[model samples]
Target: MRELIKEAIVDLKRNDGFIYVTAEGKKIDLHEAAARGIAVTPVNPKDQVIKKLESAGLHLTDNKFVADLNELISVLNGGGSSKSAGKRRSFSDDEKSKILEEWQKVEAAGKKTKAAFAREIGVGYQTFINWLRG
Candidate 1:
């Protein structure tokens, strides 16, 4: 196995509330990168809470960082569910056929790209592509 590197640099200029840094051309959360054995630089001296949490092997989710740990744990464990959480919107076969038929009219009009058409109709771009494939 390849030895994991233990150090990474934070682009302080790119700081956008969440601690994120570039690794191998992709932007990743600093805490997540740290879990993969990468250490981030310029740790804030006054941020003892983060340090304590890290030391305890606890990482906060982007949505609920300021929430109580127990609440966060409950959310993570699926006890406290959000409306959109883990649910995929599925289209019925008749809905799919109607959507594809509408797409044909849109395509014949030649005014929008596939992605733009998907957005205009409120369907996900990937989902629209899948409909086309069928």
Candidate 2:
């Protein structure tokens, strides 16, 4: 049964969805496998880490484990605090004016729309629009 579960997990990972065939050539979906007590679930990295820790006899409620888990979760969630996540880049008025001026030249060339020009220059379309408004 454990081997069957592992085989199912491998099959699911190899494919986009869960599909398995038994030794007797019986095709089964994930729900059917679950009903038969195969117990297949989607692979989650966080859950896998926790399971590994538990299997290694580490208590999830321990202070050190909890702290480490929190840190790991933060990193998985795109870094922890706002400071570590970094700040939004600030552009000076002069820089904005220069970019807008360049945009005007591109606009005159008629090769690209404002949004396309903004993308080509690596600026957000809405940010470029805001610069134009100013």
TM-score of 1: 0.36
Runs off by more than 4 Å, candidate 1: 1-82
Q: What are the clashing pairs of model 2?
A: none
Q: Residue 77 lDDT in model 2? A: 91
Evaluate all candidate structures by whole-model CA lDDT and list the values in order: 0.62, 0.67
Judge candidate 1 against the unseen true structure and give its global Cα lDDT, from 0 to 1: 0.62
How much lDDT does candidate 2 score? 0.67
Off by over 4 Å in 2: 1-87
User: What pairs collide in candidate 1?
Assistant: none
Q: For residues 67-128, what per-residue lDDT tens digits would candidate 1 score against the true structure?
A: 55666567788795464467676789998899899889888999789999888877889889
Q: Which 10 consecutive residues of model 1 have the lowest summed lDDT?
A: 1-10
